[model samples]
Target: MTPDLFGRHRAVLPDWLALYYEDPLEITHGEGRHVWDAAGNKYLDFFGGILTTMTAHALPEVAKAVGEQAGRILHSSTLYLNRPMVELAERVACLSGIPDARVFFTTSGTEANDTALLLATAYRRSNTILAMRNSYHGRSFSAVGVTGNRGWSPTSLSPLQTLYVHGGVRTRGPYAHLGDREFTDACVDDLKDLLGHTRAPAALIAEPVQGVGGFTSPPDGLYAAFREVLHERGILWIADEVQTGWGRTGEHFWGWQAHGQNGPPDIVTFAKGIGNGMSVGGVVARAEIMNCLDANSISTFGGTQVTMAAGLANLAYLLEHDLQGNARRVGGLLLERLRSVAARVPHVREVRGRGLMIGVELTRPGTDEAAPEAASAVLEEARAGGLLIGKGGGHDTSALRIAPPMSLTVAEAEEGAAILERALRSV
Candidate 1:
């Protein structure tokens, strides 16, 4: 049955839609931090469907809210007054640090970022954008233009002229050897030099933590320094928090807080885990920027009643249960365990990240070359050991990604880490 379904998927889906492992496993159902495959094999879900099942799988609060909303209405266009939509918007606006904040909903991170680009360009009246090296915003045309990761970026042609900036990855690049303060100063100087050479840029969009770039991140306060420079020139700052928002980083509610010395970003885009599996994405910004569009625009299914309901419930549960605290406690232990294991593994290049968004980068023994094959082998071996994980990186995709649901328990983390250690050693 699995083979037949896989064949059907290949025949219908786009070739670029990649799947994990040499033989893909079809997940039948999930509960808590575990999932059952079609063949009824259960495995610990460490990746949490690419970090979308944020709170948990089949969370009662979210599921109940979705069911209740669906019974009333599945969708209502943005033209109408949607109670759930308005409620969710209010919550998002208040949570967003922007003064006089406004919210615009989208169906995915791609659309949210596209909307952010539109707002930034319209408000700043420029087509130029500054994005970080080894960064990934999304898959939309405008988002792709700003993406610095070549593996995810498929085309060079774009409507906006994008300038790639340095300092997203702390362990690589020309400035990797510098101390944090020195590195921030060098990057700031480079940004100033780049601005001198080009036309005024619309905005600088960056992920506080580069999610798809193997959970790479610059030193804290780096973006704050960049913000000061951009603010002086009246250029906006957009934080792509699609993967780093909602307290996933342990120490902060948003990844931007790590660089909060200059306050929040001008525009913030978020998605992935907000709805706990339901499709919900949005951009939050100051009212002036959010209202910069001269013409009216509406999303057909962006703020559908059901999705909004799910988001509200999921968010409430996340806050009430203090899943962020759980992530910090469990994730810290997991990170320590993984680092201890990686210390003995020659192929383990680096183990880094905060909270549940940890990454273990693989490289050829005694060399800087990315060991993608080793990553793949570890992934397969981990699955065989009754654990599921993820892999991502730059063009080579040689890093193991382990982002479990935020509600992950200490026991679960220990179990998953043990399995992962065995997998890494076996590979």
Candidate 2:
């Protein structure tokens, strides 16, 4: 059955739509932090469907809310009033640190980011955008224009003039040898130099943690320093928090808080966890910026009733249970354990990231060359050992990404870690 489905998928879906594993397993169902394949083998889910199953698999609160809302109504075009949408928007606006925040819902992170780009360009009246090196925004034409990673970026054609900047990756760049303070200063200097060469960019879009860039991130407060400079030039700071938002970083409820010395970002885009797997994404900005567009704009299915209900219930559960704290505690243990294991593995290049968003980069022993084969081996081995993880990196796709559900327990972490340890050693 799985083979038949795989053949059908390949026949219908685009070839570029990649799937994990040489022989992919059909995930039949999930509960808590675990999922079962069509063959009835259970695997501890570490990647959480690319960090989408944020709270847990089949969370009761979210499921109940979705069911109830679906019974009443599934969707209504943005032309009409929607109670769930308004309620969710209010909660999100209050949570967003931006002053006079306004929320505009979208169906995906790509659309949310596209909306942000639209706002920034329209408000600033500039099509130039500054993006960080080794960063990814989304797959849309506008979002891909600003993406710096070559692997994820399929084409060079873009609507916006994008300038790639330094300081996204802390380890493998020209300033890798410098201390955090020195590194931050050098990147700022580079930014100033870049600005001198180009038209005033409308905004700078960056991820607090580069998601598809193998969870890489710049030093804390690095953006704060950049903000001081960009603010002087009237350049907006857009935080792409699709993967790092909603307290996933543990220390802060939002990833931008790591660089919040000057205050919240001018615009923020979010998705990939808020709805606990439902298709919910949105942009939050000050009213002045959000309403800058003169022409009418609306997403027909953006803030639908069912998705909003799921988001509300999921968010309430996440806050009430303090899953962020859970992520911190369990993720800390997981990180420490993985680091301990990686210390003895020569192929393991680096172990980095915060909270549940951890990455283990693999390279050829004693060399900087990425070992994508080793990463593939580890992925397959881990899956065989009843663990499901993910892989991502700059160009070689050689990093193992471990972002389990935020509600991960210590025991589950330990179990996954042990399986991963065997996989690493096997590779």
Off by over 4 Å in 1: none
Off by over 4 Å in 2: none
Tens-place lDDT per residue, model 2, 1-427, is 2789999999999999998999988898999999999999999999998999999999999999999999999998899999999999999999999999999999999999999999999999999999999998899999999999999999999999999999999998899999999999999999999999999999999999999999999999999999999999999999999999998988889999999999999999999899899999999999999999999877899999999999999999999999999888888889999999999999999999889999999999999899999999999999999999999989599999999999999999999999999999998
lDDT of 2 at 254: 92
Question: lDDT of model 1 at residue 390?
Answer: 92
The candidate maximizing lDDT is 2
lDDT of 2 at 353: 87
How well does each candidate superpose onto the true structure, as a TM-score? Answer: 0.99, 0.99
**Over the stretch 1-427, how does candidate 1's per-residue lDDT look in tens digits?**
2789999999999999999988898998999999999899999999988889999999989999999888988987998999998899999888888899999889999999999999999999999999998889889999999999999999999999999898998888899899999999999999999999999999999999998988999999999999999999999999999999998989887999999999899999999999889999999999999999999799999999999999999999988999888888888999999999999999999999999999999999998899999999999999999999998888499999999999999899999999999999987
| lDDT of prediction 2 | 0.95
Any residue pairs clashing in model 1, and if so which? none
